[model samples]
Target: MHLKRFTDFALRVLIYLALHPGRTISINEIARAFDMSRNHLLKVINELVASEMIITYRGKTGGIRLARDPAAINVGALVRRLEGQAPLINCAEPLCPILPACTLKQVLNEAQHAFFEQLERYTLADLIGTKQEKLVNLLTNHVAGGNA
Candidate 1:
């Protein structure tokens, strides 16, 4: 299944913070590292902070950091929060007359649930694991505001 850019960017932002965790990382720095627009990243960060997934600080020394330990934050839960009530297929919406006989929708629903189930087994910590150094450097050396 295809994830929206918002969810995709949010995951990247979380992973970066999970790997860093040393100090507050600037949105500009993160945008440069990921080669993504600071504006876009800002929106993603806002959503994450609103959901309590990450904490943001203002002022010159202020930046962003994860709200909790990466190991305790489930990937599936993050996805669900970031996606904000997305259904894998529009057909999954209730009250649709075709749902009773729509084999395609059923199959897609099953697949989506399976995907989420798999995500439930992992956390931000799992995603960063041994790759912390690589990810940190990747973020530090990010050019301008886009993915490296």
Candidate 2:
């Protein structure tokens, strides 16, 4: 299943903060780095803060940082939180009459499980490797270009 862009952005924002722990990341800096709208990023940041994935500090020297340790975060848990409760087929509000009889629900649920299973294989730490700088630059450039 294709994930929403919001989920994608949320994950990116989290990873950026996770990788840059101890550094107070300004929304402006993140926006410029990713070339995203400050207003939209602000909204995402607010949501992250509310979710307790990140914490916000106010005032002149204020900025954002991860609320918890990167190693402690499971990508699957974060994805689930960001994506909200998974209901891939929405059988409760079936889009088609056949949805009641279709095996699609089970299939979709299995796929969703597989997706989480794969995501659970790694923590934020797993994302870091020899190509970290390259990954960061690529993400920064792409997002800044409004391409991600």
Candidate 3:
């Protein structure tokens, strides 16, 4: 199944924060680095903050940072939470003629479950392992308006 942009952005923002545990990051900085819209990133950041996944501060020194350690954040759980409980196939939409007998919905649901289950084996730390410096340099270059 395809992931929504919102969930994708949430993962991106989380990864960025995980990599830069050295300092707090601002929404503008994240948006600039990723070449994404600040307004959109703001919504993602707001949800993260509301979920206590990341912490935000106000004022001139204001910025953002992960509230929990990278290793503590489970990728599967996070994605499932962000993606919500929307079904893969809407059986009620227009009323599928075979809705009563179709196994496609059940199959799709199982596949989705398996996908997230596999993701459960990983954490933010796993995503950046052995690539921290590379990711940091790339991100830094991107923020500097250079190709990475």
User: What TM-score goes with each of the models?
Assistant: 0.84, 0.81, 0.94
Residue ranges of candidate 3 with Cα displaced over 4 Å: 146-148
A best-first ranking of the candidates according to their lDDT comes to 3, 1, 2
Clashes of 1: 8
Tens digit per residue, CA lDDT, model 2, 34-141: 667888888888888888889999999999999988777778877877786667867666367786588988888888988888998887767764556887777677
Q: In TM-score terms, which candidate is top?
A: 3
Candidate 1 Cα outliers beyond 4 Å, as residue runs: 91-100, 140-148
Residue 48 CA error for candidate 1 (Å)? 0.6
List clashing residue pairs in candidate 1.
33-142, 34-146, 34-147, 35-145, 35-146, 35-147, 36-145, 36-146
Cα lDDT of model 3 overall? 0.89
Q: Rank the candidates by TM-score, best first.
A: 3, 1, 2
Per-residue lDDT for 9-117 in model 1, tens only? 9999889888777679889877767778889999999999988889998999999999999998899988876666555667645567877777886688788888888
Better candidate number, 1 or 3, judged by TM-score: 3
User: What are the per-residue Cα lDDT tens digits for candidate 3 across 1-148?
Assistant: 8888998999999999998896888888888888888899999998998888999989998999999999999999998998987888898988999988999999999999899999899998999999999999989977776632
Clashes of 3: 0
TM-score of 2: 0.81
lDDT of all the models against the reference? Answer: 0.82, 0.79, 0.89
**Residue 107, candidate 3: C-alpha displacement in angstroms:** 0.6
Alpha-carbon deviation at 85 in model 1, angstroms: 4.0
